[model samples]
Target: MVPDDVVTYPTHWEADVVLRDGGTAHLRPILASDAEALQAFHVGQSERSTYFRFFAPLERLPDRDLAHFTQVDHQDRVALIAVAGEEGHEKIIAVGRYDRSGPGEAEVAFNVADDHHGRGLGSVLLEHLAAAARERGIRRFNAEVLPNNAAMIGVFREAGYVVRQHLDDGILAVSFDLDPTERSLAVMADREQ
Candidate 1:
C-alpha cells in the first residue's frame, strides 16, 4: 500500500485541486514525475483502445509523446489521473488531459482502464476536470473520439455535450463544450440510462 502519507495530492498552477474517493482517485496536476507511470499505462492498454486513442498502431509511448505529457506548462497543457495504490495494486487506471487551443478554448481528451469503464469514473473525472478547466479560464472544452468508440461517445452524450460527428484533423471526431453550471450534464444524467 502506498502509505497514506506517500500518496500526496499534486499541486496545480491552473486550479485548486482536491483528492477524492479516499485518494483512490485524485484531481491533481500531472507532473514530470508521472512520465513513467503514464508511459507504462499507455503501453499496457488493449490493442483496440490503443488504436482508438492514437488512430493507429502504437506499441508504446513515443519519447516525444512522453515529453509532451510530462513537461508542458499548465497554461498550455495539464493532465490528471485516477491512481490506485495498495500493496499489489499501485497504478494509474484513468487519465485525461486538456491542452489550450486559444483564449477560452481547450482541447480535452480522456481514457480509462478497460476494466474500469462503465463504472462512472469517466463521468466523475470529466465533472472534476471540466470544473477545473473552467476555473482556469477555459470556457469551451473539446474532445475527439473515434467513430467506433461507443463507450466514450455514451459518456460524452450522457454529459450533455453537443456532439456532432464530423471530419476534424482528418478523422471522425466528437467535440464537447462544458457548461459552467452542469445543468445539461445533470439533466442528461437524470434521464433513462
Candidate 2:
C-alpha cells in the first residue's frame, strides 16, 4: 500500500509530440516504474553521448542512480521522458529535466537516444521542460555543456531565451532567462506549425 500524503503528479504533464522527421513520440513526466526503461535508454546511447551527459565514462546506471532519476517530486525536481513506438514496444528516446538550484533558477540537462539524434527531439523536449519550469516559478534555466557538443549549444542558441555563456576548464556554462524574446517566440510558433 502507498501512503496517502504521497502526491502523484497530474496527468496534464503528458503530451503527444511530433518530431521534426514526422515521427511521433509521447512526452510525459518520468514515473517510478520507468526505471528499467531509463536504464535501457542509457545503455543505448553512444560513448560520446554518454560522456557528454554524465561527464564521465559510465558503463551502466547503478541501482541508486536509477532510483534517483526515476523518482521525482515534480516541483523542485522534474523529469520528462520522450518515448517512441507502440505500447509494449515503447522505447525512451530522450529525457529532459531540471533541478531547482535556487529561487527562480534551475539547472537543466538532457539526453537523447543515439538513434534519435538530428531529429529535433532535444529542442522539443527543451521547450516542454522550459514550460514546466516556468509553471513552477523558475525564471532561469542553466546548463553546463562540453565545448565540443555543438548540437546542444545550438539548441540553446536558437531558443528564444536570452542565453549567456562562459567557458572554464573546458566546460561551457550556459544560462537562459525564461522571458522569451521575439526571436524565441517566433521559433516556438514555427515549431507549433
Candidate 3:
C-alpha cells in the first residue's frame, strides 16, 4: 500500500504557465475533487475535439473513467490539469497525462479546450508532462494520434525530442526519446526567444 504522504495532490506539482496569447493558467496535479470540472470540460468540447482526444463519440465521462483519470498515483500514471478563471469560478481548460506502458516508456495524451486552442497551451502541457515523466525515470513518450489531428501532430513534431512516427491504418503512431537532440534543443531555444 502507498503511504498517505506519497501523493501530496495539487500542492506538490503546481505551477503557473503563461500562454503565447498573454493569458495565464494554473497548472497542477489533478485531484479527485475535480470530477465536476473535468466533466464540464468534456461537455464543453466540440465534437471534433472530442473525437481527436478519445477517438470516439463520448458524450460524457463515465464514473469509472472519472475515478481513473482524477485519482492518479502520480508515479506510474501522472496527469496535469490547466485551470483558468477566478478562484470561485475556475475551470479546467486542458489536460495532459502519461500512463506507463513499459520499462522506460509511457503513452502520452493531451486535450485542450476548444477556445484555448492556438494559444500554445498544448505545447506547454507537453513540455511539463515530458519533464514529469523524465523525473519518474521514463525515457520515452509514445502516442497514437489520428491522421487528421494535425494540431496535436504539430505539437509533438515541434517538441525537442527525437520523434519516430509510423502510419498504419488510420492512426499515426508517434514515439520520442526523452533525451533531447540538438535540433530539439534549438527548437526549444527558439521558442524562448
Candidate 4:
C-alpha cells in the first residue's frame, strides 16, 4: 500500500478529450502495466517523429527505459497518455509527461503518434499536463525541441503562453509559466469549442 502522505494515483486528472477531427480519446495517468502499449506506440511512430522525440533513431526503447517510462510517482514525476479504442483494443496514441527539475519548476515532453498529428492532441496534452503539474506545485514548464520541430513549437505558441525560447546547438529551449493567463485560457477555451 502507498504511504499515507505520499501522493497516489490521480484519477481526477483523467479526461475524455475530443480531437480537432471530432475524434475522441481517453487521457489518463500512466501505469506500470502500460509498458507494452507504450513500446508498441513508439514502434508505430514515423522515423521523423521518433527523431523529434528521442533525438536519435532508436529502433526500440530498451527494457530499462520502458520500465522507467511506465513507472512514475504521482508527485514529482508524472505521465499521461491519450488512448483510443476500447478495453483490450486500446492503443496509446500519445503521451505527455513532466519531471520536476527545480523548485516550482518542471521539464515537460510529449510524443504524438504520427497518424494523430495535426489533430490538436499536442495542445491537449500540454494543457492537461500543465494543470496536473500545477496541482503538484509546479510553477513553470520547459522543453527542448530540435530546431526543425516547428510543429512542436507551434503547439506551445498556440497555447497563448508567453513562451520564451533560446536556440543553442541546433536545439530550441522553450519555457513558460504554468499559471493560466487570460489569453492562455482564452486560447484553451477557443480550442475546446
**TM-score winner between candidates 1 and 4:** 4
Please write out the lDDT profile of model 2 over residues 1-193, one tens digit for every residue: 2324337774677889888888889988888888999999998889999999999999899999999898889899999999988878888999999999999999999999988998888899889988898899999999999999999999898877788999978899999898778988898999888
The CA lDDT of each predicted structure is: 0.68, 0.89, 0.88, 0.91
Q: What is the lDDT ranking, best to worst?
A: 4, 2, 3, 1
Better of 1 and 2 by TM-score: 2
> What is the C-alpha local distance difference test score of candidate 4?
0.91
lDDT of 1 by residue, 83-177 (tens): 76662355877877889988888887887888766666676667767777777788787777787788877777777666556877766666666
Candidate 2, after superposition: displacement of residue 56 in Å? 0.7
Where model 2 places Cα greater than 4 Å from the true spot, the runs are: 1-6
lDDT of 4 at 78: 93
Better of 2 and 4 by lDDT: 4
Ten residues in sequence with the least summed lDDT for candidate 1? 13-22
lDDT of each residue in 87-147, candidate 3, tens digit only: 7699999999999999999999999999999988888888888888888999999999999
Candidate 3, lDDT over the whole model: 0.88
Q: What's the residue-level lDDT of 133 in candidate 3?
A: 86
Tens digit of lDDT per residue, candidate 4, span 1-193? 2323335877788899998999999998888888999999999999999999999998799999998888899789999999999877999999999889999999999999998999989999999999999999999999999989989999999998899999978899999998999989998898779
In candidate 3, which residue pairs get closer than 3 Å at backbone N, Cα or C atoms, i.e. clash? none
